[model samples]
Target chain A: MNPDLLPLALGINRVILYSGYVLLAGTFTFWSLVWPQGRKDRHLLILSIAGIALTTIATVAGPMIDIWIAGMTWAEVFSPISAAALFVRLAALAAAAFFLVDIVNYPIASWRRALPLTIVVAIAATMVASSNAVGGPWEVVKLVATMGHVIATAAWLGGLVALAAVLIPRQYLAELDKVIPRFSIIAATSVVVLLVTGTLHALAIAGGFQELVTSDYGIVFFIKVAIFGAMLLMGNHGRKYANGVALRAAAAARASKEAKINHDKLTKGGPGMHSLAVAMGAELAIAFGILLTTSLLVFVAPH
Target chain B: MSRPQYSLPNLRRFLGACVVTAFLVTAVAAYYGTPEPLPASVDTTSDAAAATGGPADQAPATVTIEPEPTAAGVELPSEGPGVSEPGLLLIAAPLPDGTWDVSEQVMLAKPTTSLTLAPADISRAGSQFGFARPEATSVQVSVGEQPVVIPEARVIEQVSADIPSTTRFEISYRLDGATVTTVPSTARRGIGAIMPVTSGLDPDLPVVVMVVGETVLSLSCPELSLSERNCGTAAGDEAMILAEPLPFGAAVVAAQIDIPRL
Candidate 1:
């Protein structure tokens, strides 16, 4: 078995597991906090269950695959060299368990609050800490930056999926007026963290602008940035719709009952919700492009 | 155009399309755009031998130990092209202890320690010798008590008893099946050691070998504190380079000499 394939398998496995993890965390967070009295979301529950299952499989199979690549038997997995890999596997397992717990107790306001999401975020942080991105100098800065990048990616991508899959499907129009603007804040903050941390990581690994153009690492990195830009455009489109709904709702609160009914038609019985969902879905697609580029980046050797 | 379906299944299909696209892109990048393959070790010994009008036969060279050297207080087997007289034929055969025992002709009997020397083929003509061991692994050669350091160039000539005054030699190292060639400096006028500064060369085997006239000198590997895996890198590489030459005084004075384990 070629050891080079270990990173590829691990990266793809992480993509699957992280996508699931982020979706579950984001969906549950929304359900617990924003729409506590929101309809029981069967789709969200089913997706969470499936995500947890995939993460569980990924968490177990990752180390086993690596052991095969290292040409070591299962007995040698406890060796010191395998320690970091082992820690990652263990942390992923713990995160999967937390996700499992959250799914089993679906729609329980207390159970779904912040705890599972925090665990997943912490797991992602550990992953960055153990990654090759933090291998060079200024260990603290690199680890923190990489962690921020990982978390922000998950939040943005996962949150978009939750909005399109869960909230939109249920036609939670009143909820969207509150949640979309709130999520836009989260997305905006995440984009800032991503840009700053991503630049730092690129500078640390890529050396210079010429390297970004010349090397394989740089080529894929630029593609990721392009996709992120596309995602931003789509996100901004959805943000405008959400902000428009929020503005109309405020105006209706101050104005007559006729104005309030008009506002309800604009959000609920109209094309506004469908348009927002379409834009958010496009953003979700671009998010996958970003994840794909990220996985490629992991596989490419830094110059 | 038609209000754009936003049902759960439609969203699932959209997300699924995204995942599939990502998967294809990642798979294509991983499979198609991987790094270039590592260079294979090249063996130019045959070409060198052919240029020198040496042995054309690919068969292993036979060595005969001179009996007089056994009686001359030095049991050093006179083998290959360097041997002046034929006496005993040196061959690697399995002993009763399960480990392959090198011919008694090459090694002096020591009660505390036994060594296994893998048979290496050498081709030579007049005063030119070529050595090659194609196999990645060879029989283990063990040293007892303490590691011996080869003496400086001047002493090597005195101990070997047949030193060339103007030995023109080229050293080549085999790394991952590719042979890299380098010419050793003949300025020492006697026995100049050949050392590899490159990390590409394997330290366990004949990464670099020196030929003095027609005689191929077998270098020694010191029992360093470094692990076998780390022996060829970092400080271990430095140590190996420093320990490149055999102690001429000890090699001639002792019962037996040490050779590298490939």
Candidate 2:
């Protein structure tokens, strides 16, 4: 908050932000291995861990270098090294965004599993983006909303995959019973959160409606909205699939019981009963694409 | 069949490390980088109240100006070598309206040259300033410990602030006659209201007024915004003359003109 170290503080802030992203990625990376039957490739785990460390280092470098550049009592302190550090960190944030799509095991049917990762990526991008405008503290708000949007999209898509591909393919009236209702509540809540937080982050970054459509930043935003709208449509249909409401009553009743058993098994870390992994994977892949664009958005000037 | 769940030692450890690191960094910045307040020795311009009862009517600041024999008799061309030798460094010209300074204070240890300007003929005010000079007058002298590499040598209209350039009444170093150069003292602005520093000098000695050009004047309200200006009690302003011509042997070495209050 001190003005004297304003440059350094900004630099540090960037570092702190990157570290948060790595930690986020690390949690999921760890969880992927932590679960039973998950792949235990030591090499992959090392790569993930190393990515996190690089991200963390990039975040820290932002501030320390800024401080060094702005600091020192004598006038002879300026040099090329500090400028190089800042450029490197910015590039790191962009790289971290790309790795979000590249890193990790995208589990098939559990929308719940994808939710946290999505939110983390969103928040990280938001932090990197907002760093351009509202620097000098108070930028945390944008990060929060961005993270929320991320979590929502992940959960929405992941859940859709769970319903259509996993639960539906089982073709057992039994599996639909548990998957539909549970996913219903999750999708509903996630959608609401997504709408609210997305609106807030959008308004803050775009600096209001005029800029939203006029600047290059605005065009990217418009594209993002189009993708979001399409996803929403996919999700509404997804909800119906999860609830079995459109199915014959007999099938719905039988599906209800199957869903309950499936829930119990999933909670206990047992193998999945539904065959919805492909659907969820498709949803995730689409979401990942959106996320990369979002990463690019973070770097674009709001004008 | 399972042990009771408990606290996350890892989470606690992370938080603890963050706190410790934050404290350490803050402490380091505070210790080494924090700047102390500068003392008031040099920056008294902000405190006008302490500088004066306004401009002093009490004569001018005095200073002891001893011209080395090498510089003596160089004021008027009629009194020294013909208008063709070195600056003679013998002209003991004192600066006008200098900040309170000391020769031993490590500030005035500089090589010097002098020039004079006035109506070339007494019948005019600010007109007819040309005079004849032998081609070799006013040679450059290296003054400081730093070796000065002369990049260009010529009498040009543009005057450099860093290099010593002066225009005042200068007599020939070898001949006993005066000759004014095409160089006119081009000093701009008036005496800054800031109390010029004065040095100790014997009033009995002559004070030489070495001007940059003919006459210099600074009016308060450079943009004409202020109603008031720093001038002497002469109706609208305070009249500040650099040197009152002294009797033949006596010279007025220096004077501190009160700047007009803008």
Candidate 3:
């Protein structure tokens, strides 16, 4: 309610939103790349990707259009449609996130298994969000951005969980070796996507740089970023081990063995794969926490 | 890796059921809720007039003003053009009701000529003008009524006993600001008179005073032709600062003397 605290609140919302997106995107990238079936199954990718993409599109697009309209001082455009666009975008993002979570958890062969739960969760989340509707155009923008962040997270983190706990474990060390490299490629892609998407979302929803240092939302944003920094460090280590050292050893063995031998020195045991999976899971869990906070931030007034 | 999976049709059914349930619950909450209500008198006044097809226009009304003693009776000598005015103006009389013809003032309401006097005054004036206050009064009038009211006839009061000089006191009234003047006199057998000037109070404004061993003085000055009307503020407020008389002076005079509604 305090005007001074508004920017800070926005910062918090942004931080959580970004954190969630990274987690979600990373999760999806890892699993889709790691699983032999997933890498081939574009349908599987779409189960989460479609919703997340729609959310991102709406979130990113709605605000830009609104601001452009405002900058033009065209009340005819900004005054009415802007707020509506924001809400529609918000709903899409939340739906995308809900679907993303479900898709990430979807059993390998049948996406239909996750649909019902996703439908329920998406509706419930939207309703709780609806219980706290944003009154003005800015609020709509904030909601959409928050949604993007959250959905991305569900895709990266929650999806990663599905990959590590469900997909990677079914394979032995050799298959794990192949899967780890793919997971590495996907995770790396997700991290970059998350960071970029997060920054854009923060800028639009919080207004500008002024909100970053001057508001409570800004402070919370800083904390989320700090957590994200830790997540990045952890992801980097997992990526290096999975992609750099171990996968190379496996590739060397494969090349030599068909000509000849196996590679044991590269993966000491299953622990490397297990550890990556666990790290990814930790990342996902953290992302979910961010989602919860972003959801609350979306309900608050922005500066 | 495989965990579990279900068909699309089943998922669709689940979603439909959840949406329906939430909708029904929300509808129930809205249906049971109530809104607060507004005040009764406000509703009655507005509603009754609207429902009844306009207010009744036949209500009679009246207004009664205290008689002013021609307080500014400044008898200007129908003077030579620009002649010096008199020095000791005692009594001053105000302009008559026919002055500026200001009754043409615009108003949201049609102000009626209503009898506005205490019940006892209406009874004493021998006219039962039933209206108690100006706002509550109503009177029938064709549109474009002018001068509002015309004086019907002045009332007269008769004294029965001989007046004693021993019980009298005198006060002088200066009027027309400098020359016109009047000497105070006691009530005589043929007519009743009001008290003398009090602390330079306006004579036109309402006053309540007891004439010694007689009925209290009350006068109506709808014309505002009185010396005291111009003193300052209300005649009633200034009367408070006036010097009181010895027991021999006329009876106690006060404003706002309550009369029985009947």
Write down the lDDT of every candidate, Cα atoms only: 0.42, 0.34, 0.34
Query: Per-residue lDDT tens digits of candidate 2, residues A1-303?
Result: 222233234434443443344444434423332221122334334434554465556555544433343221111111122223233333443433333333333442255345334434533453434233232223576667766665555455434432343333344334445445655666677779877886677667667778566655566666777777766665554455434432443353446668555444443222332322433444555555555555445434331
TM-score of 3: 0.34
Order of candidates by TM-score, top first? 1, 3, 2
What's the residue-level lDDT of B147 in candidate 1? 27
Model 3: per-residue Cα lDDT over A1-303, one tens digit each: 221132243334344434433433443444443463453344445434543554455345433432231111122112232333334434434444444444545543345534433442353244224222233235665565545544445545655554544434333445655666555565556566667666756665456878655544465566677777877776666556555544565577678754233455444445665676676666656656655555444432131
When sorted by DockQ, best at the front, the candidate numbers are 1, 2, 3
lDDT of 3 by residue, B116-197 (tens): 1110122111111111111101211122332222122111121112212211112122111110000000101011112222
Candidate 3 RMSD to the correct structure: 29.7
Model 3: CA > 4 A from native = A1-133, A166-173, A176-193, A200-207, A245-303, B1-262
Best by TM-score: 1
Predicted complex 3: CAPRI docking category: incorrect
Taking chain B only, the TM-score of every model is 0.23, 0.18, 0.17
- Evaluated at residue B102, the lDDT of candidate 3 is 8
Model 1 TM-score? 0.48
| Candidate 1 segments exceeding 4 Å error | A1-11, A28-40, A69-114, A207-214, A245-271, B1-262
